[model samples]
Target: MAERTRPRPAADGAARNWLGLPAALAFIALVLLVDLAAAAHAVLIGFLALAPLLAAAVDTPRRTAAAAATATLAAVVAGLPSQTLGSLDHLLRVAVVIAVSIAAMYVARARTGREERIRRMTEIVRVTQRAILRDVPERVGGVTLRARYVSAYQEAGVGGDLYEVVPGPDRLRIIIGDVCGKGLPAVQLAAAVIGAFRQSAIVRTRLEEVAADLDALVAREPASTHGVTFVTAVLLEIRGPRLRVMSCGHPRPLLCRAGGSLVPLGTGTPKRPLGLGGDRGRPDTHRWDPGDRLLLYTDGMIEARDAAGRFFPVQRLARALSADSPEEALDAVWEAVRRHAGGPPRDDVALLLLQRLTPEPDTGGCGGPCPG
Candidate 1:
């Protein structure tokens, strides 16, 4: 059963505990030797109690208490060789060692508790964020669709990156973007941008209007007061075989034609990222034939770094996709990124791919495919 097969890492902790008491006693013995050699009258080497204090950080409280007891007993025995056990001074040295160990144990426990609470909170936040960024659909406006997201750290499973697709009988609209920062505030801002897109995508006649509306929504939010952070966004609208794109300080998307040629799209001069008041530019249009694919992504995908500090080559990889469908292409791209990074990412990545599917057979009187 899966339950029986799960690994238990805690089993190793007990093995490590075996090393704790002896190490503490050895440290105390060394200090006693130094005291004897120097012939100091005062317990000048009592500072060596720090060894047990450090042990408290890794060992359980019970184990740490045992180490502290061993250390304190050793210190007392060492002092008895030089001073009488009945002397009040000898008791003071022993108490100092015990006090240091107890304080360390309590502080360590408090810190561990705080860390656990934070980890649990992070998990709850990641779950909510995933629900917000979940996939839109498998097919949209005669196109097969795929989307993927990767968070920068495994501890914090999601960040400011966002993506969405709204399918309609006559038009398909998609948005991919990255907020200026991470944390709950950035996620709230990303959600606001998606909400604006959902509300205006169908009603607005032009991509320019949608962009302006999104900018207005972000500009009016409380998060906009800082003025430094902005959302880099690209909006795409496709009506039948015609595709239009409007970029707002976001990276340009790539288009893979049906004929096996790949090219990055051009949306003219870049505008300011959303949140700063600026003019919204017009959208560039393209003709999308069946079998053509469009790739939309945030900077996180292109900016991922390897151990050598080189950035991932998004365009070069775009030209390399030879998958049979959009889903397979997205998987290949994700796998390539994982291999390049070699571990958890340093930034959140959001990707969306749309491939136009072949049209249905024509049953018109003209014996040809119907025009949009």
Candidate 2:
């Protein structure tokens, strides 16, 4: 079944687009009436040139042209009683109106063309994001999984952050990483890392080998323009009751136990971030007990700052995950993070919540009761 994601409202609504034309027409009417009322002494008709320019900034090119025509006609009408048609001064005012309208039309065309190109590129970014950062399934290897990716760039819905879940016969391997930068190059590097993770996870039996493969891929990938490309990642392999973790210069995963204890897993100093040519060494082992929840996230979560420049409190995560379901838990944390930052995160954030479900007694199936 498809995940029921919320629909986002349009950034620029249709009603907003319609405002520019009506506003331009109203301005033209006001200026025409004032020019007539001034008894031809104060020539405000030339000021009608502002109408089309205003429309060109916010309205469609066709509407901008209409605004230009309306302004020129208004100028002609205002010039009638004063110069009485065909007069040099009256013709000069009309000529000025015409000249300004032509310039406005040119501006409208150029602005409209640039907007169209941006629209096309935004569509391309959406398609690429969908392909590269496909949604994670609801469940994987007997564990309920909930994932969310938030990009700082609203135009490009996805950025340098990435996460993936690769399921084996008895185990589940997961990776969450962040590339060094942003934009298309960052997205390309993120895609490469995810690709390498999926491939290495399948072939390599050990988590260290998988991390090594990713390190090699990021180190040699030509997409790195700065040449010092690095990716901070956390790799996990969960089989039976054992959970092994290897952190490469990434935040430690938080484990919320059934008894309400929060533990930060892994030990020793974290290995250097991938692309630094350092050995990944070995993964640390931990217990994956039933009714336990594991929270894996990027640095964006803890690094998010508020108006006072204070970082988000990491301890609040355990309370946030106390919701009834994994999905709701993720939503709670996401909302809290946004609230703490006072807006969207300044950097890309990727979160994965994995809950170990207690097995059913009757059929011994993974579909078991969830802990609060």
Winning candidate number (TM-score): 2
Tell me the number of clashing residue pairs for each predicted model: 0, 0
Candidate 2, 1-372: lDDT as tens digits: 112122253536455466678889999998877777878642777888899998888777899999999999888877666755666767787788889989999998899899789778877887788788777878875688888877777765768888988898867899999888778778899999998888889999888999989989898888544676789999999876577899999999998887667888888899899888777677887776778899999999999999999998988777888778888888889999999999878888889998989652332223222111
RMSD of 2: 4.6
lDDT agreement with native, every candidate: 0.73, 0.82
lDDT of 1 by residue, 1-372 (tens): 000011234764665565555566567677777877887643754665676776666656666677677777766776665765646787787788778877867866676678679768876876676667765688754778877777675456667888877776667888999999888888888988887888898788878888889888888888788776789998888776666777888998888877667777754587778878678756776666778888888888778888998888876665445577666787788777777777646788878888888764333322112222
**What are the TM-scores, per candidate, against the unseen true structure?**
0.71, 0.88
Model 1 scores a TM of 0.71
lDDT computed for candidate 1: 0.73
